[model samples]
Target: MSPPRVETVLIVDDSLVQRLHMVGLLRQCGIHGILEAVDGNQALELLSALDTLPHLIVVDLEMPGMDGVEFILQMMKRNVMAPLVISSNRDLSLICSVENMAQALEIPILAAWKKPLTKQHLAEILHHSPDRPPPSHSTPETHKEASSTGAHELALAISRHQLLPYYQPQIDLKSGTITGVEVLARWPHAEKGFIPPDHFIPLAEKHRLIHDLTLEIAGQAFAQAAHWRRSGVHLTVAVNLSPRLLDLPDFVSEIDALLQQYQLPAEQVIWEVTESSLAADLGIALANLARLRLKGFGLSIDDYGTGFSSMQQLSRIPFTELKIDRSFVHRAHQREHLRVILQSALDMAHKMSLVTVAEGIETLEDWKLLREFGCNLAQGYFIAKPMPGETFTGWVKTQNTRRHGRRGS
Candidate 1:
């Protein structure tokens, strides 16, 4: 088979030797059009002068001036969407931090590899498809999608009950059984197909529609769970809780009433919230969370490591689960730095007697690695993307068949 076809790449490093080495590897990978820059400033200048963005960018974290982190921030500001690879000999921790920073800025980072770039690493990064959708060029459709979404439009959608709930299955890593699912809110726009939550969620919050949206999503999830219980599935259902809803005077009571209305058990539902969410109205949110927990509902500290005071939150709240963010979990098998962080997180959760879940298990290697590390549950694109509530029963059957076949083999 032929090597993957990458037409152009830009190599950013202060070291002349490193740039030359990268160019050699690009040629080896059948990538001929190579652009080199001595530092981040030079790279920006090159980018400004070019008519098109390169297919990939490989940069060193440590540079003489305008380092990789600043370069990425600048790239975000300039709306450069090229895929990124961090090639740094610096400490893996620093490289990992930079990778996280870039991801937070919405830059598509492919991988972070230790310095002294190797042909194999370059091949892996270049040939591997990123988990995220590739950045779109300025096509008319892309431009149309990028156009501003009005908060009023979202408020109208909520009022019309147009928002839908999609379920992402979570698996028991060791047993290969379907533990439950995380419910995600999806908008089925008449004209736009399915508008991503990232597009409308902020609008919901900004327009004071988050409370209604959350309730709509939770009601659907609860009713579905009750339906499944009657059908003998007995799977736990989880819903993302907006921080804005926690401060409501009736938040806990309203949620409990919904559970009773659907006839779903509190223990069978999980409320997933970020650590930062609890900070919005600390006293009220904590009281509400405590009340929910006392009533036997599961509480998860979602995206465990990304928040400002994760440890503090974990210690203070009566959380039942800890979800390691995708950034640390997805590439843990390949990046030692990430593995270190993942291991620590797993260990910490175990010591706290909280069930540990690793999200974003995309590759088989990472899945196997997390299972070996004894993660209680797993979820991501590897198992399945979020699907409609009505189709989850069939998905469970397919998963059972695959599990049985593996056992037989």
Candidate 2:
């Protein structure tokens, strides 16, 4: 049976036939509150006249006047937060680019599909709405955490030792086993609850405290890995490397000292770096990266496709892993262009002999698809959301039990 459908929908297309076709599909899927507009201008006028916004907006990329791209830009300027389903007869790559554009504009895009939409496509789009609950139990708390005010508050929080590490397990696609985890920093504010990393991380960077913040977080991560190792659950702990830390001359030695303090093997920890970060003081960063590599630590190029100098980074740094960003992984199975790009990325990584890690595997279809693509590692909400360190062992045990049961069955 189909899930509870969206209540209202607005379909904008230059073609009356196309609009009518989408209307029919929506109605067939149990959506009755439907609105139609001939083009982007008309759609905006209609939207302005409405007392309340529709639950969903379906748009065609090719329209006569005020094209879909312009309309989306206008919507962003006007601050319309309604989720969108973009349909186009244009090149799938162009549609994919527009999807990325909309997301960059902070608009919630449900899907970007080719024209002549099917009921199955609409169903999947509506099913994956931002309003829909996350599949993971711990996602709500982590994603909806309280916001922090400014650098002052963050600095205070840091001094109080409120920042801590949350571990999200990365599964080996071939073995279907948890081989590693990415250590994400979380600030559980005393009065405000969980303060997300976005709030404090930049503050730390801007305020020149990133060095201290990274070490604090790294120390906690190393300690956690030691605890896990002692428990007979050996896993590689990956830590995000700040370029600001790279600027510090003692950064590499500081990290080495932390590893020694915990008695953890250098090979057990991986440092994940972003391309933009490495662009900061390139000479120093390169030297630091090479030093870390020589010390037997693993290096990963994170958010692979999003960086402007990704290929350049690959040529310069000895990256042991390539983490494909979530944008390419989320709905690749449904979009042909995404699948092509994802496979190309995996192929390139394989050719370079770098382990490929797919981030943001949020569905069973994505999980199966990554396995088929032979992605080395997978991490996202579908596997398990980042959780408090205390619960990680239990989560691993449960996952092991499920894996064994599946094998037996």
Candidate 3:
């Protein structure tokens, strides 16, 4: 009744410590018949020697010879079809197409682990594997709802222009005045009401639709930001960039054209790079980020502290903002050690001249704690949930009017 488990994992890495630690953890997590390879060559030989195939492979990005990426390429040459979870210090597998980069090499990346691994990171990798699927319904509407929140129903929503930017205001600690808004995409299905990004983003990625979705979201966000700039608000609006678009040869040029088309100043539109997405190809990713920065776009490191984006990478990656990942912020108030961690992160970001933003704030205590740490910008449900551009504009106007009346009275 153990669900007829059919999972065998091969872990390849050069570090003896990593190998032992990972193997022990996999055993703790219910992994079966684990195999070890120190480098790509050994891993290749192991597969060649075996008649039965490994159900899964976990690889470190770095090894003495024929690194993890090279191993994946070779696996493609042999047409190995298995689920893979890459463990690496470099974080490159998450952003780059590990499965698609090598011709005809297909591996399902359950997840990528950033180095000096945490139990949480390991759990996440196991949970995200292709072997596991989050609970779902069997209805077609659910699938359609997930696909685009009725955005896919072009006939109904295309004319309606249903795609909208929902802004979550980020506050400045010194003054409670809203310093900026992080633009998040929202799709309202006629039947479903509000469909979350998690529901559809994976589908979009699977269908290679995120590239276009990113552009559409940017266009909408830029227009709203431009409107605010015109009204003397001059607030920075950050939009998440889809990883698929990052590698596109013309990503930089495309963004430039969109900025011009919307008449949005590049400085006002902050481009968010998620940690997992950029870990895959630092060179290519950083190169594109540099191009964006040179063109006047503000670069922000999204989900900071969630991956292996070292301080060195931040200093060299041309980022203008460091968003403390919610994991650290959520526990900062309850735990003393966590407070030190959060404070250190804040201190480090400020030292680097990167504006620090706290994400996933849920409680007033958490918000106050972040503010106490000299963390300036923040976003979370405690502040305001993401809503349409119109809703955000109205919220801003109302806040300003209330302040004006309070002062006059």
| Leading candidate by TM-score | 2
- The order of the candidates by TM-score, greatest first, is 2, 1, 3
lDDT tens digits, residues 231-324, model 3?
8888998989877767777899988999999898888889888876665665677778889999999988888886775565576787889998
Comparing candidate 2 with candidate 3, which one achieves the higher lDDT?
2
What residue runs in model 1 are displaced by over 4 Å at the alpha carbon? 2-5, 14-17, 27-30, 62-70, 127-147, 334-340
Q: Tell how far residue 122 is off in model 3, in angstroms.
A: 32
Instruction: Please tell me which predicted candidate would have the highest lDDT against the true structure.
Output: 2
Q: Distance (Å) between predicted and true CA of 15, model 3?
A: 46
lDDT against the true structure, each candidate: 0.86, 0.87, 0.74
For 1-409, candidate 1 gives per-residue lDDT tens digits of 3756567788999998888889898888888889989899999999888777787889888898898888988888878788989989888778888887887787888888888879987876866745443453323356465246677888888878788889999999888899899999999888878787887888788878899899988998898889999988899898888899888879999999999999888999999988799767789989999999998899999998887899889888999999999988887887787788899999999998999888888878889999988899999988999999878789888878988999899
TM-score of 1: 0.87
lDDT of 2 by residue, 27-85 (tens): 88888989999888999898777766777889998888889999999887766667888
Error (Å) of candidate 3 at residue 186 is: 1.2
Question: How many clashes in candidate 2?
Answer: 0
